[model samples]
Target: MQFVFLLHEDEAYFEAMGDEEQKAVIAEHFAFVAALQAKNAFSSGAPLAPAMTGKLVSVSGVEDGPYADSKEQVGGFYMIECADMGEALDWARQCPTAKYGRVEVRPVPDYGG
Candidate 1:
């Protein structure tokens, strides 16, 4: 099974961190990825820019940022192949974002066409 971990964090909380503290947070992610790679569970992952840089497009027009204001925004994502939800949950539990944020674990469906 494949799962995508949506990392959500409070933008303000991260921005409040000192330069060194922010760097350490990023380093934690690197270490987490390394652990996943060692287990061959890491498929791909990358952090997203701040939500302020995002845009919402519709048939009528485009809106700035998210449709609604929210403190928790998706900060990044990680794709992993695992044996089952049990194992995937374990990995999610180890995500660094869990310290000051949330990690939403969602399964990827296999489509046949």
Candidate 2:
């Protein structure tokens, strides 16, 4: 099974970090990803820019940025192929982001065409 882990962080919380502290936080996750890849437990992952860079595209509605002004925003994601949800969640638990915000583990839909 494949799972997509959504790493959410409080934008303000992250921004509040000192430059060195923030770099350390990012580096922690980078090391984790590399380790998982070496163990063949990681598929792929990447950090997302702040939500302020996002656009709300509504067909006939307003398209806007800075989305909701919420404290929490999705900061990144990882797609992992695992034997089961249990295994995937174990990896999620190791994420450094968990210390700061929430990690949403969602199963990717399988659309066989």
Candidate 3:
């Protein structure tokens, strides 16, 4: 099975970190990726730019910034192959983002079948 982990965090939470602290936080993500790769579980992952840079498009018109009003915004995601939902949950628990944010684990549906 494959799962996508959506990392969500309040932008302000990261901005409040000191320069070194910010670097450390980013380092944690790098380490997590390395760990996933070591287990041959990593598929693809990346951090996103600030939410302010995001754009939303609807049938009516295109708009600037996120369309949803939520305290936490998606900051990144990781897609990984796991044996089952239990395995995916294990990885999600180990995700660095869980420290200061949320890591939502959702399985990818196979529409081809």
For 1-113, candidate 1 gives per-residue lDDT tens digits of: 89999999998899999999999999999999999999999999999998889999989999888544678999999999999999999999999999889999999999954
**Which 10-residue window of candidate 2 scores lowest in summed lDDT?**
62-71
Candidate with maximal TM-score: 1
Q: Report the lDDT tens digits of candidate 2 across residue range 1-113.
A: 78999998888887888999999998999888987888787888889988878888777876656776567889999988888899888888888988889899999888985
- Model 3 per-residue lDDT tens digits across residues 1-113: 79999999898899998999999998999999999999999999999998889888789988898655997899999999999999999999999999988999999998997
Clashing pairs in 3: none
Per-candidate clashes, comma-separated: 0, 0, 0
List candidate 3 segments past 4 Å from native. Answer: none
Question: What lDDT does the true structure give each of the candidates?
Answer: 0.94, 0.86, 0.92
Query: lDDT of candidate 2?
Result: 0.86
Best-to-worst ranking by lDDT: 1, 3, 2
TM-scores across all candidates? 0.95, 0.90, 0.94
Number of clashes in model 1? 0
